[model samples]
Target: MKWTEVQEIAIQLSERHPETDPAKVNFVDLMKWTMALPEFDDDPKHCGERVLEAIQQAWIDEVA
Candidate 1:
């Protein structure tokens, strides 16, 4: 999945990190975790602050 797949990424992240809280995640960790996904395929440089924020927000929403 690409950076555009924010919701999907968030869902996967939430599922993988059930013990962690989304709001507590920093962008650096977020980036690392997202990149670690087997389905994730994209340039790391494509992840800007806005995209990271969107992913984090989606993750928070997903957990809620």
Candidate 2:
């Protein structure tokens, strides 16, 4: 997805999960955390993939 779409999803997630620490909600940090997940460790493009998945999942979980 486009960076703009990713950002929009992140914002939606943040709004839904208001208890999450605001300091921890920025795009770069979230992408870093997602990339560190073990499941993506072997993927050569893990950083970008994880960032996209993280944003999407965050948005989904926010509403569920």
CA-lDDT, candidates in order: 0.97, 0.53
Global lDDT of model 2: 0.53
Error of 2 at 31 (Å): 0.7
* lDDT of predicted model 1: 0.97
Candidate 1 lDDT tens digits, 1-64: 9999999999999999999999999999999999999999999999999999999999999999
In candidate 1, how many Å is residue 33 off? 0.2
Off by over 4 Å in 1: none
Q: Which stretches of candidate 2 lie over 4 Å from their true place?
A: 1-24, 41-64
Q: After superposition, how far is residue 37 of candidate 1 from its true place, in Å?
A: 0.4
Pick out the ten consecutive residues of candidate 1 with the lowest summed lDDT: 14-23
Candidate 1 TM-score, C-alpha based: 0.98
58 Cα displacement, candidate 1 (Å): 0.3
lDDT per residue as tens, model 2, 1-64: 3333555555654664556764445656666544444332334244464656667665556555
